[model samples]
Target: MPIIIQPAEASHVLPITELVNLFAAENLMLPRTEESVRQTLADWLVAVDPDAQPDDPPILACGALVPLTETLVELRSLAVHPSQQGKGLGGHMVNHLVQMARERGYHQICALTLREQFFVRLGFEPVDRWSISPKVWQACIYCPKFHRCDEVAVIMNLVENPQAAVHPLARPAGWNTLLKWSEWQPLRLAYKQKQAQVQ
Candidate 1:
């Protein structure tokens, strides 16, 4: 059977959500809301089952590329249904997203993921999580495990020329020092202490 890759339609929302949430349940990825998926539908791509009957399922796999900055985009919600795994569907979706990023003139694409090998297999290199833009951490601050984030940052440069240099998030101008996870240990301890005092 042929798998067609195309822009996700409105009907794909539920299947995409269900596929992604399966990984979310295992903490492999973050859970996504249907509303959020709808808002960024344009960024999503889906693989469809070509030979299904009328009442059969429509989408087979899905993924999206979310712009994080003018030159950077984050690949989000990459999910392949259980039945569709190991068939190159995930790689196909990644290739589609990378192509889209290149088309939009993005310099780099990054993913904060536990699946480091998977991203590396797709040409992404491991990078320090602290090297990513601060905007990437905005959502992390609200997460329960903010201080103990386990995801690693992986990045792929889309452009041929080295125009924009990647900046380290912790060393923003006027900041005292470049604080990475290890260096932030004291800060996390202080935060916990402060929270204890408030309680």
Candidate 2:
């Protein structure tokens, strides 16, 4: 069966939410409201199986790229159907989104993910989450487990020139930002515990 990769339509919104919420239920991601999906519908890209019968779901996978700054975008809400995992559809969707970001004049794209190796294989390198925009953290602050986050931050540079690939973070997050520092402490402790367990 052939799958089509394209901009999400109004029809795709519900399926995309359904697919993403399935993972969100497993604590793999933050649950999205239908209204949130509707609001950011334009930012979303969906992979659909157009030839499906009446019983089939219209979407197989979906992801969104949200701009944090003119040169940077945060890749979020990426989800693949459970039946569709390990089929390379996730990578294909990411590549398509990267191209779309480049076309739109973005210099870098970033994601906070537990699937670190997957994004690494797709040309993203590890970066400090604080290196991303506070707008990114603004969304995280709403997450229920913000105090014990398990996600890793990864980024990909889109410049054709190697030297231009380095993206300078807008403002470094530090002690001066009292609220962010307070929020990060628990996650820091959780990471330390994980590290201790591995030792």
Candidate 3:
């Protein structure tokens, strides 16, 4: 099926929620409520047959680019309809969002994903989950599985100068103030808690 990648519109909310929650039901990804979807609908991208009529596109796949901090964004809630699986639609949506992030001046994009290899194949490198800023945990704190979260963090640099765009959570010279450390400390705790549970 021919599909186009485009920014999601207001009318796309219900289908996007349904698609995301389909995977959520199977423990594949985080579930999204209509309110949550509505709140961030502007950041979402939809894969649909462009020939379809106005206001009711059949959203074959969907995802969102959620800004986590000034220089970092998280790709969350990526989903593709089961019938459209393995057709490279999910990858297309991801690349589209990555470009959007680049254009918007984000230095890095990351995702907490169970499908680490899939993102890896798309040029993302796996990183320590704790190595990400705790801002990534805002939505996570609301999650029922927060105490036992099990998602791998993967990141890709959007800048042409990768070295210049250091991962936001990396500690650097003179940056050891309490405020900075406190801001990033939570993910380390979350990571260790998950690690201890495994052992």
Every candidate's lDDT: 0.76, 0.78, 0.78
Off by over 4 Å in 1: 54-56, 142-145, 165-199
Report the C-alpha lDDT of model 2 over 89-169, residue by residue, as the tens digit: 999999999998988888778899999999999998877776565556656765777878889988887875323323343
Q: For model 3, state the Cα shift of residue 160 in Å.
A: 3.2
Q: Which stretches of candidate 3 lie over 4 Å from their true place?
A: 51-57, 162-183, 187-199
Worst 10 residues of 1 by lDDT: 174-183
Q: Residue-wise lDDT of candidate 3 within 105-132, one digit each (tens)?
A: 8877889998889999999877777666
Clashes of each: 0, 0, 0
> What TM-score quantifies how close candidate 1 is to the native fold?
0.78
Candidate 2 TM-score over all chains jointly: 0.80
**Best candidate according to TM-score:** 2
Q: Candidate 2 has which clashing residue pairs, if any? A: none
Candidate number with the higher lDDT (1 or 3)? 3
What C-alpha lDDT, on a 0 to 100 scale, does residue 15 get in candidate 3? 93
